[model samples]
Target: MPTRPSLDSIALMRQWLLLLVLAVIAGQVLRLIGMPAADFLGSMLVAIGLGVRGARIRVPALAFKFGQGCIGLLVARSLSAETLASIAHDWPVMLLATAITVVMSLLVALFLVRYGDLPGSAAAWGLSPGAASAMVALAEDHGADSRVVATMQYVRVVCVVLIGAVVSHALGSDVTPPQIPTGTAPLGFTVPANGILTILVLTGSVLIGARFPAGALLVPLLAGSAMQLGGVFIIDLPQWLLCLAYGALGCYVGLRFDRATFDFVVRRLPSMLFSALALIALCALSALFIANLLGKDFLSVYLATSPGGLDSMAIIALDTQADVGLVLAMQTMRLFGVVLIGPYLARQIIRLSR
Candidate 1:
């Protein structure tokens, strides 16, 4: 006969089941409200609550790697010939905006290091406007508190999403958000050859890059982007699959927050909020200058210059009918810029802080 399940094992199963159901509900609710990264936020919130209440759960290391890989592919899907051409057409303006944005983020990180309780590495990684999950992984490699880095990143994400929408609407994109869902839509409702190939590509890339810092995300991202832009293969992923990846990554981060780490964040929450708003304001000001120089619409320029929130920015640009291509080109450039320069910059900030 098979061995009997222990009481602890059965209870753990129940906890996991509850976590799944609640996470999906929370994610959908947030999504309906136009929150960026709803799935990640939803699952994280649920996991944090459960963790604080004495629930024992953990995401596997492999699961975390896979989650990072999915995010890489998500970012990669936006890479296309059109996006590249847009950048080439506006290379000067694009380069200026990207440089200024990176500087602004670093300045904010420097402020946090000088005055806030966070260490320099944590502040730098947390304040970086690149992909939130990718930043957190890099933070881990650099000896920052991953929990603190995560809080800083997602907090900024929330602020950026809300402000981006309000600005787009104020500048006269659709006065109301469109009912359509945002970002790279899945190839179809069904999985096809492209989807399978994409999955294989993601898995293989992650495995290949597994030994490096943020290799899982960085490798797949670069590889998938090149292949997609070169017309090597169409990158397709089902909605359910991406959701699973998002949830896995969120839960892994959230569940790892012990009571002490959570308390540390709560005490510093106000500082984090201030930094987020400041970054958005600074970026908005830059957008105004860039728009005047290029003779473009203010809304389109703002969306392009908005720090982070690539998907949310895309949604706002499309729904409000802003210059969708320009916004994507600028945002994608910043995404890659921060990803490439982030590690070196974070180290420099840490050194300067000391």
Candidate 2:
């Protein structure tokens, strides 16, 4: 006779399954609510509240880390030699914009530190443009509080996503979809062996070098791009996987919020908010200048300038029916470029200020 499954075991399995389902559903619901940017932030908020109340809710660290890694891989795929050529052709404008953006971010950080009364480390983390995971990692490396940096970076992401959407809508240019070529085929599930191998190699290299965070973002990106441009593979990471990753990331971020961290954030909230807005304005102005110089439309310039997720911004480009290709290309280019050069820039800023 076969034994029936224990009631307790069955219940546990059910609960686990339910949690996964809810997380995926939550991501879609958040996106539909026009606050998709808050998917992770919202999850974290819930986790923090549970923790504060003494509930034992634990987020799996590996899952969260892997999810971050996937984002890196996807972003890396957006790079190409052709994109590099375009950047080089417009080298002066690109360099000018990049330089100005970095300077503005640093200025905001300094202001927050000196006048906003925030700690130097907190200010530095808060002013880091996009690349939230990387900023948090760098903060930890430099002996800064990871929790504070995470909070500030995520907060800025939320702000940028919201503001970017609103700005696009107001400009009367938000009705177009992404302009990137969809290639010759309809979007479908088609994975290539070479793509997988490339991911493995890139990821492995990053891990060996002790740059896991960089590897996570860059590996998938590089692999995907190679497959995409070589006409051998297509970028087709499952949406469910992405949602799962986002949920895990959200849970991890939220769980970091304890009473002490929350209190600190509250105290520095005003300054953080001001700095975020100032940085956005700086980017927007810089975008306008680049637009004039490059003879491109203002919308393209605006998105390229705005600091947000490459995927999220790409989605926005698609939603607004804009040049999705160019938008993705620029976002991808800037992300890797920034990640590669972030340390150097941080050092330069510290040196120049000193």
Taking all chains together, each candidate's TM-score versus the true structure is: 0.71, 0.70
Worst 10 residues of 2 by lDDT: 177-186
Clashing residue pairs in candidate 1 are 173-320, 174-320
Model 2 lDDT, residue 306, Cα: 75
Q: Using lDDT as the measure, which candidate wins?
A: 1
Give lDDT: candidate 1, residue 242.
76
Candidate 1: global Cα-lDDT? Answer: 0.75
Q: Rate residue 297 of model 2 by lDDT.
A: 82
Candidate 1 regions exceeding 4 Å error are: 1-10, 31-38, 74-78, 119-122, 131-151, 154-191, 229-232, 291-354
For candidate 2, the lDDT comes to: 0.61
Badly placed stretches (over 4 Å) of model 2 are 1-61, 68-88, 145-147, 168-210, 309-354
Question: What digit string (tens of lDDT, one per residue) describes model 1 on residues 1-354?
Answer: 886333234488898998899999998886676554567768877887776565677888788888777767766665567766766887898889989999998999899888787889889899888767678877888788897888888678757765775565455444332332233324332335677678899899989977765577668878888877766666776778777887897687667655666677689978888888888899989988999877888888887888765655654564565676687668767877887888899999999999
Which one is best on TM-score? 1
Per-residue error (Å), model 1, residue 131: 4.5
